[model samples]
Target: MAYATLEALIKQYGLDAVLLVADRDQDGDIDADVVEDALTAATSEIDSYVGVKHRLPLPQVPDVLVRVCGDIALYRMSSEGGQLTEDKRQRYEDAVDYLKRVAAGTASLGLATPPEQETSGDAWFEAQPVRFGRLL
Candidate 1:
């Protein structure tokens, strides 16, 4: 993802505000320690700290997914700026569609699997070796 491009789009489209939904156990508070950890963990040059307008704490993974989907919908529907042009409109639509699928998947997983166990962050890191090949 191009952070500079995304930032430009946000400014051009007046999408200055964003609502970030994350699991309460992970990102409830914007503490310096948390920020530093995220910075250390980030694999891309794009700043991880950006795009957070308001942090909505969620107790469960399903709840977090639902809230994020809702937030994306709300942002797309907001009338604070002019109607989005074709390219921007398509981008927003694509993002919302992807998020919807993610939310559905998360909900299904939450239902099928025990809630007491969540995938570890290491699982994500381990997959990256085979998934992304190498970081640019």
Candidate 2:
């Protein structure tokens, strides 16, 4: 599953705003279809880099991922814009780092495995919680 969708992006940023940034022409013209294609590319790139297969849908999507997708599309549409500020670049880099961390967190969660495999036999007993008081 894609981490982000065009509709969600549109909802996050108003249609006019998203179009202005994402549209290459920037003529106050917006094409949902073209914008969607850019979103698809961004999603694919994110998934590929994060080492997450696009087939499994994440239970919860992160807002940062959505923001990254929008940023990526806007950057591409800006005609090799040399005017991007250092802060924007820093934020983009930070977003990518956060994405990697999220992917790592999911990997640790082991969500891809079956429910039964979440805990098996001695695995649960290996690290039992400490108990201070006995029940009556």
Candidate 3:
């Protein structure tokens, strides 16, 4: 994943930071040092983001929670086919549930509002018509 893209996403969403976690699956061995290096590079490129390596116990993996401006956008990045698993999906749902519980009270991260759409410089040009005739 490109760190620049991640940074742009954060900025567009007005998020404080994003949490990244990774794990290896059964029969899949990866070099910890190499992974660490990649993670370091990603963090260096993106500000306020933290990466952590976790070892999941049998039948379960760690849930990832990203606290952005008090609202959490949770995600699960699975090593298996690099797809999100049901457990992680559930975790994300649970996070939303928790958010509703404490929405009325104050929190350390603060309440997060809905993310705003990012504007592009050439957005209008893309939708406008172009002159095809030659202009002397």
Candidate 4:
């Protein structure tokens, strides 16, 4: 699943801003595919960094990641729409910087590490007592 949804993006950047950057056909509405593409790409990028520390496909989406993903996806859409602004660029950079910090263990996702599996180098076998044995 994508780290950020279109609703999350709209919540962060406003619906008009999303449409402005995502309406590639000039249809006066948000193109779901366009937004999904950006969000999917952003999610993959997030995984690359977050995977270094956390497991793939986190059990729950962090609020921080949702905001970061929104920023990254919005930056991507703006760049594709030829409307990239300094603020969008800076937000993208900041998101990536935070991801780097996460990868470097300088930042926290507040998720507990999964327990490691246990293994042993021993084996044993058991057998039922023979029923036909003669009494001593």
Name the best candidate (by TM-score): 4
Q: Please give the distance, in angstroms, between residue 59's alpha carbon in candidate 3 and its true position after superposition.
A: 35
- lDDT (Cα, 0-100) at 94 in candidate 3: 60
| Per-candidate TM-score against the hidden true structure | 0.26, 0.53, 0.24, 0.83
User: What would the per-residue lDDT of candidate 1 be over residues 32-83, giving only the tens digit for each residue?
Assistant: 3322332233212111212121112222334333333333332343322333
Superposition TM-score, candidate 2 onto the true structure: 0.53
In model 2, the Cα lDDT at residue 131 comes to 75
List model 2 lDDT by residue over 30-104, tens digit each.
666667676777777677655453233446656666787776654444334343556546655766676676565
Whichever of 3 and 4 has more lDDT, that candidate is: 4
Among these predicted structures, which one has the highest lDDT? 4
Each prediction's Cα lDDT score? 0.32, 0.59, 0.32, 0.90
Residue pairs in collision within model 2: 1-54
Q: Which consecutive 10 residues in model 3 have the weakest lDDT in total?
A: 49-58
Residue-level lDDT of model 4, residues 1-136, one tens digit each, is 8999999999998989998999999979899999999999999999999988777779999999999999999999999899999999999999999999998888988887544211343563458988897889
Q: Which candidate do you rate higher for lDDT, 1 or 4? A: 4
What are the RMSDs of all candidates, in order? Answer: 16.3, 10.5, 15.5, 8.9
Clash pairs (backbone) in predicted model 3: none
Using TM-score as the measure, name the better of candidate 1 and candidate 2.
Answer: 2
